[model samples]
Target: MADQLIDSEIIQRITKKKKQLDSIRPLSKSALQKLKERFAVEWTYNSNAIEGNTLTLNETRLVIERGLTVKGKSLREHFEATNHKTAIECLEGLARIKEPLTEENVKKMHAIILRSINDTEAGIYRNVRVRILGAVFTPPDPVKISRLISELFKWLNSAKMHPVELAALAHYKLVRIHPFSDGNGRVSRLLMNLILMRCGFPPAVVLNTDRKKYYDRLKKADRGNESPFADLMAQAVERSLDLYLEALEPVKPGEEKELIPLRDAAKGMPYSPDYLSLLARQGKLGAIKISRNWVISKDDLKKYVEKKKSKS
Candidate 1:
């Protein structure tokens, strides 16, 4: 359904990077373990925070890794942190076995997300109409939810498109369905990453920092355009690829495509730092934002210039 909505450039980059990651075959064991641990923690923290969980990243680490309840936080918030970690473990299991995601998996993911928080309504769909507070669209009537979900799974079964596109659309479809009253957003993101992992891609994290952009993209999708959201997902996927490759596949000395601050990266380049930063923010350039600063690899800078040159 979303074969054409994603930016071709981003898709091509993912394709290239996926091939690169694949060529390395098995990643170093220790590095892979450490990376997975870090992602599991970051993923849990960001996903829960987006849902209003008050635990900071370090506190989330303590809760999940150290099994300590954070002070000044509610029991439900603690459960959210731990529950999300368990749900991610499930996704990792599914990814390892290469299991096809079923309708049951969807419910199970939601259930795990809502465990200890709302036991009764954990996996069950709402029986009444509901509206997202800031969303531009209303979820389908509760009666239609089952049928809508049925259709969604049918698409999941037979859809033929880029995995990244398919994953992004799946997330959008679930969020639009709003299958469960409370944990719909969390489940949608989990499902998205599950699809990616099953397809041999790293789990793409939708950072809590980008929650507003995330929702804005969804709202735009509601307005008959899926590109913005799909693009957002593609960028997330690319970021993870960079993360994994940096940790697992080091380049030969003096040839590393190391990421540098945009200002330093632009010192001798044709594009000014501000101009390149604009492009990066717009998703036209491959870059990663660290805290408040944006960084781009020299290779990505050259790639951007080559593409623009050809277009011009």
Candidate 2:
């Protein structure tokens, strides 16, 4: 049964391969192009959603480009508003978790995620009791939730576990506790990405595109089967890393003389060509002028892109 829950060897292999690949994989041009495109779309969508705008893809793009603020719509008007809140909460939750997780941090994340919702205690753990999938999962009685969470953080601090594996475990444990009445799924995933970002990895956005697979994997993990969940998470991580690498093409050995084209530099960027040119003029970028064309370094463009992202 334990073997069925988690494949120890597979876990080991994933950890080993992740480390090895991190060291050897060089950024490829094609991958970088695809990554930039995806990131442009994702950032537009996510930032709008975070700011309480429930927008479709087209609307999101327009909003990002035109600087339009969503107005007159209640928070509930957004598509899957509750879920969006959950996702946003997840991202914000991660940003605030200090290294070496703590009882305070867990509660802090829970509180932030559940702020406006009416859940028994709102942000507090259930004092009564509850069950999940017919299994009675209870929070620590009264004050014990804090203590148990503290201990969990302590274990996380001391364990020699790979950060990714630790992320997976944290997700499982968080859901098992069912700390909040709602938003546990979002919180768990947010917690997962929090660990990932802290470990120098990019954020993994789990789109609603694979809702069925997502829930099914979670159910399987609940039944003492972890591989399905682990595999799903691994794929998500790989996708995120692939996109990130594609966005930021690492400088290769002896390639400094090969100038990056302006069109290519702005390939995945969300800003306009005119805006990019202005940025270059401000000494914010290293650009090359051609016959009626301008090119900037991928690195320089990335900084401008990030600056826009920060403002959004």
Candidate 3:
């Protein structure tokens, strides 16, 4: 089952990329801090947005950093952004210590995520039976949650696997447990990145635009096909690794890293923008999604071409 959940090609690619990034360890503090700020915003905005938050990425930034309330958003949306930011901070603190993921840690994050939004339900498992809106599998009854979570930790502690695979499956297991009444997805993702960050990978931001596919992949895992969900999370970790490598690597003045949408990135290339988009979505190309548009640097495009040619 772990083999089915570990797409070898994607997992190998992620392992290779992470090793490449690790070679340049001890990055400058400024560069690291800048990436932290950027990713924190992207991470908070996209995670909340997947759950139907109305704030735009920039609006989320304003709420977290500038503390400015946006014109048209609800107070709950504002709290979601700020609370996620706080939870990220707390998560980072936990990452610094190499402790096993525990029930207390999970509850702490759930509490931060639901703070001010659902005070009564924050950090607490649901007493009432619940149903996911579009899920294929029913969540276990309220009484089963605590035992299931404990069992998950037992498996997590003893399972032998790569960190990326471990992180993604850990996410799936938590979602399967549906431990909390609210904030389950948010807490799952937070736990996902906590696993990754503890293992030295940057936080993987699952884009809001990828929400449909994201849920679809999870549902596939629910049906006992874990490969798609594993690939999805592997691609996310790969994307984050690419981001950290790009930001931490220095460039000459005349050769600054430039990110253009796939349309512009495809010019003079043999691949069409659609082809490139497919590659990007499949994690074969190093690209970033800006809002709904996928963008890549000229250098990365070149690398993709070179890598493909070599494989051929």
Candidate 4:
């Protein structure tokens, strides 16, 4: 009961924050474009990395941006990054139409994920039964894969659960089914974000740093526990919402100043991010807190530098 109450509280908080975010709808075009690009690289890197892709985040960005391959990474790694980007674009199209989740849509995405890598298995159901290493649950039989997927889509359409819960459940159920020969995890994550995007939430990235927790939560869900997985999804959505809301905060006309993160503000300056953060924390810099990060205006950094020069 205590855990249930806590989960309820968290759901309420997520809903409240989501509502606040929706109130600021239609984020400025530039900010929206930047957020989309940023999330695309991040989502691709983390999703592929969680599956053991060796490309660093910077390397992933380079491949996506410059179409340049890294020297040390495998060809498959590069394809994974590009393929996942294509999958995100496909998700965006579905979200625009508010399309209901379907097995065909899922297969289309799985095909994109495996494109140029495994032509035969791409977008097709598995004929051989396989086990997810380290998972507590085994996926359904090969013969039942289509049926299970159809049932999942049916439930998704009729279920009236909260959007976060629905997204988590969609991911969890797909993983349980493991319908495809490969790319199941990647496709499942795509489906999760598809549900979220259609429901007006930003894509919730399950960071590679949290790979262990992510797997553990899925395992817990396998054991008939949904709280951990649901909590994880809610937190992911909330983090994205906070980021979007912060980036999209409108500027007032009379204000001649704006705030930027310490790292961005420190660019081309002698000060490093850590040094700037220290100054902000010490109140020696004209900076303000937004969420857990500190932001400073260009003018404020200039003033701080001038004041230091005079003292010297």
Candidate ranking under lDDT, highest first, comes to: 1, 3, 4, 2
TM-score of 3: 0.92
Number of backbone collisions per candidate, in order?
A: 0, 2, 0, 0
Quote each prediction's TM-score: 0.95, 0.56, 0.92, 0.79
Candidate closest to the true structure, highest lDDT: 1
Q: For residue 128, give model 3's deviation from the true position in Å.
A: 1.2
RMSD of each: 1.6, 14.3, 2.4, 9.0
lDDT of each residue in 1-312, candidate 4, tens digit only: 233511664566567658867887766889899999999998999999999999988899999978998997888899999999999998999998855768889999999999999999999999999999898688889999878888999999998778888888899899899998789899999999999999999998887876898898889888999878877777677667756766786645653246688889899988888988887654456455544577766756786788788989
Candidates 1 and 3 compared: the better one by lDDT is: 1
Model 3 error, position 275 (Å): 2.3
| Residue 138 lDDT, candidate 3, scale 0-100 | 86
- C-alpha lDDT of residue 252 in model 3: 55
Candidate 1 off by > 4 Å: 1-3, 309-312
Worst 10 residues of 2 by lDDT: 1-10
Q: Which residue segments of model 2 deviate by more than 4 Å?
A: 1-74, 77-98, 117-122, 131-144, 250-312
Q: Compared with the true structure, what per-residue lDDT tens digits does model 3 show for residues 200-293?
A: 9999988888899998998899889887888888878877876787788666576535677888889999988888888887766767776778
